[model samples]
Target: MPGPVFLEGEKVTLRPPEEEDVDLIQCWMNDPSVWRRALDVNPTSRQQCAEFIEDVLQGDDGVHCLACDDSAPLGLVSLNDSQYGPDETSRARDTELAYWFDPDHHGQGYGSDAARRMIQYAFEDRNFRRITARPGSFNDASVGLLESLGFTHEGTLREAAWFRGEYHDMLYYGLLREEWNSQ
Candidate 1:
């Protein structure tokens, strides 16, 4: 029962998703390149995207932050679809971390910096014992970023996600609170 969470990093700062971000988010979602990475095929209209953002802004289950710099929007980072651990063990407190930066902003370290900030918030502020990130096996950049953040590659679900044409393996990475704190 702590206060709300706001994450700020070296190259990027994460704020609550805003109305203005709807347009940019819509563009990202509609882009085939971005959607394929997330295994999203159905097209969402601008209005649907706006409504989704509104829903996200209203919810409290997880924190969804818009990663940005001084000039323009970079991408989104969210600790979403959280499921509390049934018991008191370490696995009982964890959440799923998801993030994406515009393809144009790729390789600038924004995604990695933003993810590091979010994971920090998850452990120190949210009291989560662990955080899990699932990225497609073909998404080398995302996998590398997660690995760079000290997320250990736990497992892969073979042909679990269908994206452009064929099914792709889904890779899951995990980082424990204590492990991150030790780093």
Candidate 2:
């Protein structure tokens, strides 16, 4: 919506999701590994995913963009205005960055590339003051990606998220515009 038409990386392109991308979204979201790492076991129905695409196009709280490459659909990346709740992000001029990559493309730097592009757009194009991200404490790859992009590890909420059967921590990361500019 308010973001760019397309963001380019070396091996991927992040573009606004289209109606045709619904099926591809379903496929990636339904992947067991994706569910485990990203969605935390919440199953997605086709109808719900259709609604999601509509929401994305309409800028439903700033969710946008699907990542793809010449190979196939890779995953989804978003710059959401809201982080934990409607109240929090509503007060701050900040956005939350979230992403997931297909298991097949893991460790190929697609996630980092997409995130860096999103950060650049948020700071330069959108004029955002800061961006925040929260990743599951056990998710090392996500933590590494955020850290590599110069996001500060703000804190960890202990046992804040319950996934599968047990409770897991959530690590909060943030990058300020001043910090990004300094880099």
Best candidate (score: TM-score): 1
> What's the lDDT of the predicted structure labeled candidate 2?
0.79
Write down the RMSD of all candidates, one decimal each.
3.9, 3.6
Cα lDDT of all candidates, in order? 0.82, 0.79
Model 2: residues >4 Å from true position, as ranges? 1-5, 83-91
Tens-digit lDDT track of model 1 for 1-183: 011225669998777876767778899998888888877788989899999888875466577888888647788888875566433354568888998778999999999899999999888877888889999988999999988989999999999988767788999899998889889
What TM-score, computed on C-alpha atoms, does each candidate reach?
Answer: 0.90, 0.86
Best by lDDT: 1
Clashing pairs in 1: 85-92
Which residue pairs come into collision in candidate 2?
none
**Alpha-carbon shift of residue 149 in model 1 (angstroms):** 0.6
- Give the runs in model 1 whose Cα sits over 4 Å from its true position: 1-5, 85-91
